[model samples]
Target: MFILGISALYHDSAAALIKDGEIIAAAQEERFTRKKHDLSVPINAIAYCLKEAGIDVGQLDAVAFYDNPILTMERFLDNLVFAAKTDDTDDLMKFSYDSIFGTKLWIHKELEQALGGLGKLGKLLVAEHHISHAASAFYPSPFEDAAVITMDGVGEWATTTIGYGNKEDLKILRQINYPHSIGLLYSAFTYFCGFKVNSGDYKLMGLAPYGKPVYYDLIKERLINIKPDGSYRLNLEYFDYQYGRAMTNEKFAELFGGERRYPESAITKREMDMAASAQKVVEEVLILTAKTAKEITRSKNLVMAGGVALNCVANGKLLKEKIFDNIWIQPAAGDAGGALGCAFYAYYQYYGKKRVIGISDSQKGSYLGPAFSDEEIVKFLSQNEYPYEKFESAEMFYQKISALLQDEKVIGLCQGRMEYGPRALGNRSILGNPRSESMQSQINLKIKYRESFRPFAPSVLKETVLDYFELDGESPYMLFCANVQEHLRKEFSLDSLLDASNMDMLPVVNQARSEIPAVTHVDYSARIQTVDEERNPEYYRILRQLQKDTGYAVIINTSFNVRGEPIVCTPEDAYRCFMRTGMDVLVLNHMILYKEQQPEFVEWEDWRKSYELD
Candidate 1:
């Protein structure tokens, strides 16, 4: 039976399709709508999935939604107990809620509308938010049975949940409700640090290594009350998110010493320290929760899915603690992955289908999005009159790209299927020589047009993973950070730099902390993606060719898009990004286009205004 899944009316809205328990296609609405973190109905995403599956929307045997609107409304009304009319909530509802919630609560009608009247439609099921998250975590994991943890901002009435899954059955054993959320607490710090809540939390995580966790004690004592078992309560007096749009109130600002920084403003030591403090608290809470999961469920394997699970630094620390013998994190851990999860819930839980164990995971390396064949790419380039060269073979492609990379050329790769999650992986990535000391600054300022403080990730060959980063097993999704090997790390003096009253982060960011200076962060840690031949053979072959030519099996891999833009979803999107950026080369399937060979391109508008900076 075919099943359609959807996560919508929240951030990272997406759609997933599965046939006979096999996942077929998935895509985010932001890709098609050109809106970062688009939360509308994922109509475009649903259309794409239907096309990829070679079926009409009405062909689906069943449809599942990631969240239950009734429960979510209950939680929203329950929060009124603490603060009523704090920020003119009536105005808030009238402003956007009427349009948003009215459509959302009647999602069945919307689904029917999208399905073109829903011919022979089966059950339209809705799973609770955290239940969807838990199903997403445990169902596709490599483990036969595992303890599941889902932690994010308020979802229905749950913010955090601990559960156990065995075969097709999953049960929630514990829950921490809304208003006492680890995700919201961290998001408050994210806003105070001058970043967007869901979209910019990773930027806050990236900023943590630059400063000390001096506010750790203060945050624990005043902002949140944490129990040894990992359940926590938020000090509601300090936060304003319960009532309105603002994450924090004046009390929170006064406690921190000043008002929250403006977006895209100066990054001071205060912001860095706060990021570090919040990151530390999150790591501690996650580890404590994992320990409790092991104690209660007695399961050695653990699976996780949530927005907070996107914090790779916290994930790395939890992995290091070894609270579970194994951990499998949903790559699309945010609400987007909830689409995939709810589908699994419908097939396995609602329909009582048995889950046949997989050797690794059902996610298929998350390379499940649209892919352009060489013929399609070449046809587009030829028709557009774009100057390009078509490689004769995979070997020729790999050899030439490896040489170009060694010459310090930054290449944007749009090959194979797009990655399902936030990470670029190998298919849709901008690659650079990691050994180059200035590559990070060059890419950040000249290409990405984002903060210089953010670090790049390394896509390393899985066989040689131990040669570089201190990591075991596989990290195919680029979801974990590990320290550089001791031999590769260089001795650096940061004590004097940290002591400076006016600290310039540029110097700290530029410091060569390891042999692969571009990918290494200030703390000498790298978010590593272990590449194997099985999943993405073409990328694996290119790395192998690079290893053969330069003796280094690693290269820098960042998403192939400019700041605030979603990763390129089409060949035209890829070409536009390449033309606008300072990238040296653009690889679209087998065709390669050089910057100097292309004609001068005019953007639709002043390119910077095209996207709101995240």
Candidate 2:
């Protein structure tokens, strides 16, 4: 049976197709639309999946939406009624109610429209929001039985869910309901720290290590009442998300000792402290929650999927704690993964089909997106009259790329199948020499055109992971951070440490903190992706070649896109981004193009303005 799964009308909207429980294709709408966090119905994404499966809409046996819209609307109505009873019916609240009521109440119709009409589409199956998340986490995981947890901003009436998945059956054991969400609490801090809420929570995570968590006690005391078993409730007096569009109220500002930090304004110690405190709180709750799940389910393995699962720092801490024998996190742990989850849930639970477990995961390394043939790439290059050279063999190509990395050239690589998750992995990545002390700043300023504080990830050969990082297991999804090995770290002088403060950490951050300085964060931690040859042979070969030449098995890897843009999806998208950014080389399949040899790109008038700053 062909099942089409979708997550739309929310951020990171996406579509996925599964045939007999195996994922055929999956992609986020942002990739095709060139809109970061595109929330519109994933029409383009749905078309891609259908085309990839070589089937028409009529061929689909079922269409499973990630969440039930009716239940979601009920939550909205409940909140609206509560607001009315409290005599808090203002224009903003009314607008909120009307907007949600008009736009969200008719999601079934929207689904039909998205599928090119209900007549052409098949049966419509609706899965609960958190159930979809849990299914996505456990169904595709290698574990046959595991404890499951899903936490995110309000979904229907649930904010957090604790569950267990055993083979074909998954059950929700306990839940923390709406209005008291860890996700919303983090988002509120994200907003207070001057970042976009949903999208910038990770930025808050990235900023955490820069400051002390001095406000941890204050946050727990005044904002949230977290329990020993991880069940928590927000004080509600300080938060505004329950009734207002803004995440925090004036009382929240008073508690934090100031107003919300203006976006793009100067970064202060206060923002850093808040970020640190929020991150600490999140980590504490997650650790406690994991323990509770383990105690409840008595499962040695754990699976996690949710927007909060994207916090690699917390994941790393949890992994280090050894709460479970093993943990597997969905690569696309956010809403995008919900599409995959809902499809799997429909296939196994709704249809009562037995699941065929895999040794690793059924995600196929999260490389279930599009892959262009050499002929297609050649055709595009030839048609565009682009300058390029074809490699004689894969070995030769790897050798040449390795030499470029040794020479400190930033190369945009588009090879094999595109990744299904938010991460670029190797198929779609901008790679650099991790050993270069200046590589981080160069890529951030010249290539990515983003904040300098953001740290790049490293794609290390799986066999050599322990050589550089203090990690015990595979981190194939780049969803965990670990400190650089002591031998690899460059000891900082006492003067440099004393001079570094929240306001001016650039001096310290610019210093070589480790052998692989480009990927190493200021805290001496690195978000690592262990590249196994079976999953991505080409990328593994490249890293191996770099290791042979430079005695380093790691290379800097960042998503293959500039600021405010989704990762490049097509050869055309890769070529445009290559020409637009300061990257020195573009690798399209077996062909390579040198930036200096390419035809002059007529700069658009203020092209930077085209993309909205995130």
Model 1 misplacement above 4 A:
85-96, 498-501
Pairs clashing within candidate 1: none
TM-score against native, each model:
0.98, 0.97
lDDT of 2 by residue, 101-184 (tens): 776667777878767653234557889999999998999899999999999997888899999999999999999999889999
Off by over 4 Å in 2: 91-95, 117-121, 493-502
RMSD of candidate 1 to the truth, in angstroms, is 1.4
- Quote the lDDT for 105 in model 2: 65
- Please give the distance, in angstroms, between residue 359's alpha carbon in candidate 2 and its true position after superposition: 1.1
Error of 1 at 297 (Å): 0.8
Candidate 1, 1-614: lDDT as tens digits: 78888999878999998887888998889888878889888899999998999998668888899999888766666655445545446634654466446776888888777767543455478999999999988988989999999999978889999999999999999999988899999999999999998899999999999888999999999999999999999998898788756899999999999999999888988998999999999998999999999999999999999999989899888899988899999999999999999999999987899999889788888998999987888889989899998888878988999999999999999998888879999889999999998999999999999999899999999999999999987898898999999999998765566556266767766778889999999888899999999889989999999999999999999999999999988998999999999999999987899999998897668888988999
The window of 10 residues in a row where model 2 has the poorest summed lDDT is: 493-502
